[model samples]
Target: MSTTEIKRIKSKVKTNSKYVSLITWIVMIYFVFSVVMLIRAAFLPEEAFTATPGLIFWQITIPINAGFSFNINIPMEVLPNYEPERFQAKAAFITYHSIYLLTYTSVLLYGIRQLTYILWSITDGHTPFTINNSVRLRNIAFAAIGNALLAGHIATICISIFVTQIFSMNILNISFSGLIIGSLLLVISQIFRYGAYLQEQYDTTL
Candidate 1:
């Protein structure tokens, strides 16, 4: 790549990468806050928990603004029946949510981190066609696929246990976007790998 092109790529990515980094930080902070709150909420007084008529879950809400609010739900606990066993179920349900939060956040941060690195690589005196970039893209693609496959299975299993033992229902969920995008990215990663190989040949010829 030419000096001017490299400079341009660096300039563009510097701004975008900074924004992505900011978002990552925000997500981290939110996750920590959520974990602490989820734990505390689990053991809250009965008054803190509410169940609407005909609703299948209990919820607690904390006001953020006049119109904004933070809400947490306890699953598998039907309305008007605050059985003691529901407390244990609440703890288990909270664990599933915590796992979901951590998993989602980890995938999000890692994928964007790799993307940021890929963007800035050109700035560091390296061409866009590099094996490192292909590997990073591949990592992101696999992460996406794994996340898609694992998507609702965790929560479904968690909730399904209660549903089967207590209630009766069917559950099914899938992340089509993740599957499609991940598959496309896998192809793109291979293309990038081939491009890097060709770039190596060109450099060697020079």
Candidate 2:
């Protein structure tokens, strides 16, 4: 090919890559907006947690269990039906909310890391799933592990709440169960870290 032809080919490749990157950025922005809306709509309102059975699940349950009160904790002035057990339930609610807060932090961290990977991949003009572009994929996998750990936290909280509130399980048993789950999560996360390191080495060699 002539010199001019070669230059035009390279220019086209760069242009296409930039276009793809722009689309990626737009999609990521939409994703972030959706996530924020979901959290607000599903969990933040008063009616969500105190619904029919008074049991909110998943991400919504996290804040409820964690005890972040954005006007949701206001007590009814008139106790419609006074019961000692009802007061105990309210105390339990507070404890659950506190636990949820800790777990929610993990989720938010993982989510931010995931978005970082997406942005980096787009800006670098790197394909997310190619051997020649393995570094970006490795970053994505690390983010996945973060997400997995956060998911595990949610699961442990849910199981504990179910055992304690629904089935009246013992506290010691619940604590032990959570410990085991957390340990497994650490092990899984380490494995992902190792894989990411290996991919980084491979990329450097290339």
Candidate 3:
């Protein structure tokens, strides 16, 4: 790309990174609030249910389609049926959800941070086709792919210990989208690495 085009792209990425940063902060706040809710439910299930009277935090694992479950809302009257009477079940549910949330959010945050760094480098007039950028993209791809493939399984295993008793756990979210996107990112990273090699060769010749 011409220098002018590259500059324009960098400028755009810089502006967009600010918006991404804001979204990351919002998600962080949401994660904190979700953790707090789970903790309250673990200790005081009744109190937590009272706060969100109509909704219950449980999942049905029978996927309606490949890797995705039905999202139909349950009747508010049915909420009482799902509530676990025993504290152990409630605590197990909390633990299951907490681990999954922590894993998913951590991956998301790390990917965004790396992306911001790449954008900042471009904005600072560093070439986008650098070895460092290639590595960052590959890292992001792996992290996302790992989360997509294993987060649900890990959370399910944690909750499965209390399988005899029904636990109020969110549905296992095995996302095909993450897997696809990660694979695409990995390919893009390889392309970037090749571009970096070419860039280095050009510089050496100059």
TM-score of each: 0.75, 0.31, 0.72
Choose the strongest candidate by lDDT: 1
- lDDT tens readout by residue for model 3, 38-75: 65555554332321223444442222346643222222
RMSD (Å) per prediction? 4.7, 11.6, 8.5
Which clashing pairs does model 1 show? none
lDDT of 2 by residue, 118-198 (tens): 445444654333432344334444444544444344434453453234323222222344345445645544565565567
Q: Pick the candidate with the highest TM-score.
A: 1
Cα-based lDDT for every prediction:
0.68, 0.42, 0.67
lDDT of 3: 0.67
Candidate 1 regions exceeding 4 Å error are 51-69, 72-89, 162-172
What lDDT does candidate 1 reach at residue 64? Answer: 41
Off by over 4 Å in 2: 1-90, 126-206
